[model samples]
Target: MVAEAQNLKVSVWRGTGETGEFETFDVPSRESQTVLDVVSWIQQQADPTLTYRFACRVGMCGSCAMMVNGIPRWTCRTHVKKVSENNTLRIEPLRNMPVIKDLVADMDPFFDKWVSAEALHHPTSTRNDAITPVDATTPERQAADAGIECINCGICYAACDTVAGNPDYLGPAALQRAWTLLNDAKDGGRIAILDAVSGSGGCHNCHSMGSCTRYCPNELDPMSAIAGLKRETFRHALRRKRDA
Candidate 1:
């Protein structure tokens, strides 16, 4: 595999609860090898005590995200050659979250942010009522569909400095979901959702660092999503002011 002679020196974190060290391992590099493959090799060949979290080796699960070379990414899809620095790699837990152990960062807060964002849909029509049809090609739905493929990997949140600075900020993923729901013409909670994201710790809090968009694996622009939220919130505020 991969010429079987060269060695890759990798430094990985080990342990949990604020007690851990960067353990080094040497493994043979291979063609088209991903970062997850290298880490699995270390656990099987080098140290059995290594701790991490991974459900699927593919990118769909979004469970294998971590800090690769100080950038948040899905390790399962990340290639060794793409992230390795001078034949070495430093892997750690994702930022802005609790480290469970080694590379497994706790995702509880990340999910909670989703709940706080109120990104869920609330149907106004009863089940007995006539079904309403929506055109998928509409401008609003099309804009919503552009960034709707997010896998909730938390990479955007980890890469966001606004989330790191203000714990109350809903972060990009949740806001992206909110955008999707808000654009749905049939959703009854549009005004409520606007109210939710327009207040303190809302869209105005974003500093536009663009790290979330820069590091997204799916090529989404959460920065743009946040800007859109700002505009919508301002429009809603002006409407309220005029009504008052």
Candidate 2:
């Protein structure tokens, strides 16, 4: 259908928060043109006041993530030809977050969840202490390695249904970060981190629907990380009961 068309019909959200409407624009299509390119064209050619966010054009930064035709994706990496249907495209801000403006969701809440989950590493040894060597072959190291690549793109957060149902939910990325820290051998706050993620609105709230894993751009399995948190929390609960 798009083969015969010289221009693509793109509908982009135009407002702040939930008060937006889709504004249609006819974008000229080109070979290898990406969704970001379409949005940039609309802003530059059609309307100069249109607002959006993007940093690295390459896929490494994950700064160009947005909802492309109802799916969260890195616009910098998503080619318009692949996602557009019949030469039509719909672009919107990521869901389940406060939108600051068109295509720019406030990332404060997402990062706040990371802090609430205690996702930061707590060092066990001081710099004055002897250097410690970590064995990469160990299972704990492997587990930590599995989730260490997340760039906080928030794609998985937007894809999570639990976050939609429960605003207080920690979401996948935060919980995945907690799991990575939990497996870290030199981390001093294992028990405290476990306590943080095990409470209400934490890992227990995840429905394990696998939406987070399904939309993760990095191909990381956050569902597996959440499952790991569930098991570790259960073990901790059991140990506390036995100790009591």
Candidate 3:
């Protein structure tokens, strides 16, 4: 029991995979406390057995992302006072992901989906060839630059309702990557990438709810990228029909 009246009530999910319960903790409240600080205190003072992931306590690394009050946020940067209501906070592992432990979500499936979307860069020229100069003034280069800042943070994936309902959806991040690569002048996998995204679980599967863009900590508009893919794939389809 909290001996003082100025304590924060925290409910954290504790379980592996899909099975577990929310364990409540009473943490002393402070003026400048972040949610990460509360979690660290719980592990050190409350329960040493508690498990969570964090690095670079700043916002640079997104490893500290978790569901705080049903929204995915980087715990390292999120202030406790800003998100807490009535000094009560409910924390859980990221949704739409399999929990490996108390606060760790398995990221293999997310990356696998990324690969399925053909988000990787495929070179157009051999390494021995001269470096190709890309002009930033071009629309293609600008499009790629807009989303190149993504560091594979799963926050957007967790925020996407399409991913939650459709097991086959390629996801916003993956599709956004595909759009970036499609706009790259040096990318040689345009046809394959287009073909992959044009099929089932592709860009069309998106409902355009914009949840991914709305919750992105980086403020990237993945919805716009997906929209670009829709237009590109439509034009690609028309060209194929015209040639046939």
Is candidate 1 or 2 superior in lDDT? 2
Give candidate 1's TM-score. 0.94
Candidate 1 regions with alpha-carbon error over 4 angstroms = none
lDDT tens readout by residue for model 2, 132-190:
67889999899999999998889999999999999999999999999998988877788
Model 3 scores worst on lDDT over the 10 consecutive residues at 1-10
- TM-scores for all candidates? 0.94, 0.96, 0.95
Residue-level lDDT of model 3, residues 1-244, one tens digit each, is: 3244589999999988889999999999977788999999999999998899988998877788899999998888889989999999999988898999998898788889888989998888888999889999998999999987886778989999999999788898899999899989888889989998988899999989999999888889999999999999999999999999
Q: In candidate 2, which residue pairs clash?
A: none
For model 1, what is the error of residue 95's alpha carbon versus the real structure, in angstroms, after optimal superposition?
Answer: 0.5
For each candidate, the alpha-carbon lDDT, in order, equals 0.86, 0.91, 0.90
Point to the candidate with the largest TM-score: 2
Measured over all alpha carbons after superposition, the RMSD of each candidate to the real structure, in angstroms, is 1.5, 2.1, 2.4
Q: Rank the candidates by lDDT, best first.
A: 2, 3, 1
* Clashes per candidate (backbone, < 3 Å): 0, 0, 0
